[model samples]
Target: SQTIHQWPATLVQPVGSPLSLECTVEGTSNPNLYWYRQAAGRGLQLLFYSVGIGQISSEVPQNLSASRPQDRQFILSSKKLLLSDSGFYLCAWGGDTEAFFGQGTRLTVV
Candidate 1:
């Protein structure tokens, strides 16, 4: 079965703290992976994406970075957190036609 798993489903961190969020996809290889942020009443914003290992594309400039350490593992990290960074972070993986999303992590930076 193919599935995507994201962890620490919810988080509360003080400003200037560090953050690391992870996601892994199973049952697939060389999949297109994505990291997105969703804020209340707003559409999803693509933060980073990877088409293959070591091939990351950033959609916007922000306080976050992403890395694919393995074929199926993706990580989002931040060295210093900010209150404005609080949001619902999502990880997804897919082929050209369909995509599957993880449960997501709700981050609150104070």
Candidate 2:
């Protein structure tokens, strides 16, 4: 049974602060990993993705970055946060056509 875990479930941060969010998977190997952001009343937007360890692709350029160091571990980071960076961040894993998501992290940038 494959499962994804992300945390902290919620966060509140001030502008210009550094950020780090982590996600890990179990029961799968070399699975595709993705980072997505969903703004209020908006749809999910892909932020980054990785096919394997040390292989990452950015879907958007902003105050966000992603990394895959282990086969099942993905991390999202930022040097400085922005007000627009506040949103629901989700980590997902899958391949081909379908993906499964984490519970998501709600970040509030003040």
**Per-candidate clash tally:** 0, 0
Cα deviation in Å at residue 95, candidate 1? 0.3
Candidate 2 on 1-110: residue-level lDDT in tens?
99999999999999999999999999998999999999995899999999999999998889888889899999999999999999999999998899999999999999
Predictions: Cα RMSD each = 0.8, 0.7
Worst 10 residues of 2 by lDDT: 59-68
Give me the runs in candidate 2 sitting further than 4 Å from their true place: none
lDDT of each: 0.94, 0.95
Q: Please report the candidate that would top lDDT against the real structure.
A: 2
Residue 109 lDDT (model 2): 97
Q: List TM-score per model, in order.
A: 0.97, 0.97
Model 1: per-residue Cα lDDT over 55-110, one tens digit each: 89999999999999899999999999999999999999989998799999999999
Ten residues in sequence with the least summed lDDT for candidate 1: 38-47
Deviation from native of the Cα of residue 30 in model 1, angstroms = 1.0
